[model samples]
Target: MSLRQRPLQASNSTSRTTSEPPGQPTNPTQPNCHPSTPPRKGIRLNRILGRIVPIILLIYIAFAYDLVVVRYAHRHLYLQRRRTLLPIVWLLPAHGLFLWSLRAYLRVFFAHSPQYTNKSSGLISWLRTNFGAAFPDPDEAQQLEQQRLNTLATSLSNTEVKIELCQADGQPLRCWRDNCRARLKAFRMRHCGDCGTCRVGFDHHCAWFDNDVTAPATLRAFVAFLASIPPLYVIAFGPLFPSAWHTLKQIKDFTASDAVIRSKWYNKWYSWIGGPAFRWIVGYALRASRWPKPSKDRWPHESPRTPVLVALGAVFVFVATALAASSLTQLRRAMLTVDLERAKAYGKLRLQMEKLEKLTNGSDVEKLTAIRQKMETLSPTQYFKVSTKDKNSGEEKESIVALSPEEGLLSRGSAWANIGRFLGLKQASSSDGPAWLLSEPALRKILQAAALLPRENSN
Candidate 1:
């Protein structure tokens, strides 16, 4: 879940304490456990930063809007005799894109509808979706989640896969990392430390949005917002293209003249005052602003701040492109943001396994030894509890199985199928048939590639 840009902790603690802030109410069933440990300062800091990041981002966006629309289009272009109507032409689609992007931005930040399906959070969630469909409806999602799990259990019923995510006594898994034992009902649920809840399709907690991007609600909007950037830039800058080109020429010309750097008033005034870095920055600003540049009657299009619009627009374009690409790549692979981080750790093990496969067994003793040493250090990222049957007694026993190098935890096969699920594009199936999979981050084909597990688990 990008607007940019955990290992399985199967905790079995049944402590009744809810993870609330210092001043908030604690769980009445459990005794207070605060005195045993010092309060973590990091949590308080994360709270402060999360609240302000979106505010700062909005401020930045607002500044760009003013610079582009008010300053350049209205003020400068209107004054230009032949171009009076050009601002309207440029701003019509520009404003449309801007409003659409703004809506998507807010949706990305706060539209966690699927997570709010319960009576407590129901009304607001309905309002967020206009009391209509965004993606997966709450009732449908719950049904789908149950169906997916049932099918999964059925498939692994008689298999030899050693899974490890069983709660010791059918109790809920405690997320010690977040200091919460909240029930995670959503598909592929992960507890977001910042949000203080397990979000449905929980991706990562984005610091910039100050929110979590759980799919079927915020994922589509996040992608839409990023995708709008290039078109928005093109529309906003269409009329100002000539002026921008001229400004680039001024900067280029300014750089070639050594005399301008040492003698221009913009450069000379603060040259000694700011040590060197600050003065260098001021010089860069001058290149875009004042060097060989002022007309007899300078318009807002020729203002020093014009470069700010260009630079910001260029940067957002690049950022949106990169973040969008990264997100699509992950979605196509059937993993969310948190799953991607887990993959990075396991990816190292896969590389070694591939190398070992190429060489004959025991052919190079040194290479084999080095591979073993590396594998020992890089333990499997996640463990799942697969039920093993005792052949004679006909009883099932659960064993914690580590992921083999070639296997992944989230994939449900084909890219199209994965993306269809990620976007929540598929409608719910009949309750009798297999419902749409929200995500299979539980266990990919964990047993299909079981040959390496025996050796790696030994390591």
Candidate 2:
């Protein structure tokens, strides 16, 4: 039998029915099948409350005990007379450093940069459509999809292919190819029909600026990424360290006089400053106070100051290294523009384009147009252009130009460069060339340097 002439199955086999035994009545109000409910706003609210309430309560209790119990006991026993404000002094800077490190860590983990935003939203949506629908078990599917996407993205860096093209005049076109090196180092790539070249590290297509994000904007983005560390560290570590140390010590031995004194200080400090004080101030104060004074009597007990200073120094060094590496990479990318321009001056750029045209099949015009339209909306300038264009126009003419190697290279670097400028960093220039500029690896490295990745299974 022909495929179209295959037998049809009974609809009743798949369909639900309300038939029942004698005396039973079907409930008309009930849904045909229980519809899956979207997670409610209250569920998110409860999650937030659950996480926040305990931290808040613990902080509150610490402060209360220090004020009502520790202070009263110290005053009653005249132990407050020998106390020097020196502990507070050390506590302040120490606390500040701890908080700074914490802030840096959290920022690395939770802070969203445009680069991160693009990757996450794209990945999440892709996973949702691909895996979410294909698998029967939604939760299991999501996990599998996430793992698959990450693996695919990592693996794609090594794949290389040569694209062949032909000229419009029926001349045999040459092949255009990029090696594994380029693919591995690329932040992203964009195909621009008008320019007839593939740009690398393309940040975003900006129609409003009439330019893509290049040079300065990319630098700015890096700066912004770096800047976020200080604040995030403060938020994560400022209260957490001091509160944690005091709490831990309290657990081990409640009778230590030093613990009692530190406890008193924490209570007053929390009340006076917890509500609105800047994170830096709180951190500084915490660092200055000596809870358990340096004791040479025990082999395992190292000087508290040494560990605190070492940690702070390590963090600072990592941040510095990341900043330097990112800056150098951007410089190298800028230099590529000059190289490309020189290649174009020698007619190589045109040759490469001709080659690309020869090797590939006719343009996937519909796919290209759709991709361009999607990209245009991402930028302000493109948004305006889209708004101005008539919706009914099925075909919009695109200007095609042969770019000099420099122009081609610049086009590739422009996206990240623009992001840097947006974040207030110096623009990439033609004189400097580095491999690290605006690449995803560089971004990931910066995050790692900032200690953004979880050290343990926080969840």
Candidate 3:
């Protein structure tokens, strides 16, 4: 009996020990046992914030502009001043700027091309057609693709954009199979995951525009849209303070008038709905109201608009001016917002590469190759010429460097030249076109003859 009891006790103890290890979870089968709750909550919070912030900003801007400019400023301007035939001239360039800005904003916010539409005829059928379309005749497909690319290049060149292939030591370097196919299909094109569409020279997916802002065609419109806001605000509210002051005086005088209290319409309405409750409600509203009290002091040129409205208008003007200045700087540098973002990423990668190189004494070919591969992935189109020195021999060795376009690896020409190209004064050209096609320099001279009018002139 003792031997049997001892064996049973030993077996039970061994089973208990095997089932539960030290400092381990008692119930591993439970789904909530793992500590993954905080990360998921954080992700959800971020997603919510990302959407809410943009909506809040847009709503605030709309409300501010409506109150300060349209409702208050315009009304005061018309009330105080007599109407004139050339009232359009009052907002120097703002009315015109507003129109152009609105046009460009519409272009960016809405579809500039039919390809941006999501209304598919048949999703399954379209997928089936495209899936097997490449199978029938590979050579024929390639040739047709080449022609399409050439046509696209010609169109861009006519618009005054300078697109070129990656050159190594003054010679055009060939790309890998996938990149070569991409080049043939659409030069420097990228598919946007957020937009779920392929855009040429894909810059970035803009949540504000709810679209992808890309190169060649839409870039000018985007810049114009940014450039238009400041002037539009100036034209709309340049005389806001004066008009608001006049409106305040008018309101004060009207409210204080014996005629307003004793008017037949007011007397009839007061009699129809007279009570202590109504009087109390009216008293509360008067106290709660933000409207300014009547002032005894008068200025030479007092505006009829509200002081609050004038302050808001001024704030909007300052904000627009700041945004305009930054946008103009980006234009002069020929740098897209996306480009600036990419530059930051490229700089980070360079720092990492330098650290890795130092760790391996700059001789770890495999690590160097991995870093280079990442750099290439970020900016597939731009190229750089880099030099590194040998630690032992101090000899300099040159290699073709691949950096993201955000890093500005390519030439932006002069500020005026870039502006010219952006304004369509210069033509878009690409070296990715067929070898038989005319070179960029030669085409530039010829295409400049048919330059479009500058943006300001058209407006």
Candidate 4:
């Protein structure tokens, strides 16, 4: 039998009904018709808190130690040494370099676009539809779904065509022979409208950067985090190196003499310059500065004169910056390579050539050849003349529903929200509504796909 003669099989048996199409609207008299709710601000806040609280606590502790403990010790020492003009030469540039590096980090993070969210969503929707399961199983169900998709594809390709005449610019034009011809043309493809998810790369939806953390923006943010290391290390260690060294050695506690405290403060002078030039000067000063004496030194002349701690800190900063720059460059190169590969692959599938081949049936091959010649005369971009309206009714309709603010902010779109909004939250404030009330796990799974959080790191 011809492929077109085969009966169309239902994509799913349980979820669909014989009376209505999949995802079709139901009668108002139907019981258990619950509408979904809009996502609550409280749920969003909880998710944000879950991810942020631990990091915030760590930062708070670190800040408290620096402000309360470190600063207090310095004050008690009454370090009243004259500001040395020699160190200022090195400090200014070092400070500038650190700031410049930080700015570069922020720039990279913000430059990343959220284009990948749509792609990921499309992939997910394709899997869900083709598999014929809300969640795929490894057994017989998965195999059945795959078979159905293959059958559907083959049937679509083999369907017989009939010619019809249409008036265009007062001239007769040939068009397709199908019942839903207008809808098929409107969507550009027949099956796409029936598919559950939006087509990836074909359609772009607004994406929340936080939802797709692996998106360019998130990756850029990660890169920025990495780039921040050198400057942060330098700022933390440059002036504080001597004090750190003293603390580590159990030599004079931060409760030291005024001269020693002033010396420690002056040692970090390179931090003021804030750039590479400042770094060079700071390195030089650290190598030249005298080391502080130990309280229990049996022999005064035996103490080391070199500022070893300061020299080491400068070396660490330079090495860190070099590594971060190299890594960022490599990552950018890899992403560009992948994009080029995808473009090359897409270019090979010429839809116009496929259309021409479809027209060449029986002995009318020469007629089809002439049509192909005419098609080739047009520019590649102009080859596919997509009409804005259905030829019969001349009414233009959107293929995909545009997302609204509430629906656009989360999930694939408003489909999930219908259920959430239907369930009114009388017990809690709108802001405190729990995510669990709106299928928390499924929402989280979608958000995770969007990359709002770090991916599971196996290593």
User: Which runs of model 3 end up more than 4 angstroms from their true locations?
Assistant: 1-94, 116-185, 242-335, 356-372, 379-413, 426-459
What tens-digit string does per-residue lDDT give for candidate 4 at 135-230? 111123224333433342342343221111111111112112222222112110111121112121111111211222222222333345456656
Q: What's the distance in Å from true for residue 395, model 1?
A: 11
Native RMSD of candidate 4 (Å): 22.6
Instruction: List model 1 lDDT by residue over 1-459, tens digit each.
Output: 110002112234221222322234435433221222222346555567778977876777787778677777766767654476777877887888888987888676655445455534465665555522233443465566555555655654443322333232222223333333333233355556665544556777766566667665577777888899899888877666677677666665766675665577444665768677777677777665445455757666765456656777788799889998998898887667777764565477668766776776657766766654444333333334344553455554443444432455555557766665666564422222221232344333433233212223434
How many clashing residue pairs appear in each of the predictions shown? 7, 73, 19, 38
Task: Give Cα-based local distance difference scores for all models.
Answer: 0.56, 0.33, 0.43, 0.32
Runs of candidate 2 exceeding 4 Å displacement: 1-84, 90-105, 111-323, 328-398, 408-459
Choose 2 or 4, whichever is better by TM-score: 4
TM-scores for every predicted model: 0.61, 0.25, 0.48, 0.26
Sorted on TM-score, highest at the top, how do the candidates line up? Answer: 1, 3, 4, 2
Reference-based TM-score, model 2: 0.25
Report how far off residue 428 is in candidate 2 (Å).
13
- lDDT preference between candidates 1 and 4, better one: 1
Better of 2 and 3 by lDDT: 3
* Model 3 Cα lDDT, one tens digit per residue, 1-459: 000000000111100101222225335443212332111122333344546745764675576556544544354344444444334456546556666766675565554334313354575445433321111122343454445434534544333222222232212222222112222222234444444334444555655455556654555566666666666666665655456666655655554564534343334556447576675345323432533443435432343334544555566567656755665576566655555666667578789999988898889988887666555444324332222333455444333333333433332456764454433343433322321122233233222322311112424
Model 3 residue 281 CA deviation (Å) reads 27
- Report the C-alpha lDDT of model 2 over 1-459, residue by residue, as the tens digit: 000100111111111212222124424332211233232233333345545644653464355334322432233223544544643553456456545543433332232223333455676545433322110122232243334334423433432211111111111121122211111112223322222223333333222112233333233333343554455444333433443455444433433444544466444656456455454344334544544553443212122332343345347447646754555454445432223333334354344444545665436555444433332222111000000111255222211111122323233346566334323343433423322233333222222222332223438
The true-versus-predicted C-alpha distance at residue 324 of model 2, in Å, is 3.3
Q: Kindly report which residue stretches of model 4 are placed more than 4 angstroms away from their true locations once superposed.
A: 1-34, 40-90, 97-222, 235-239, 251-459
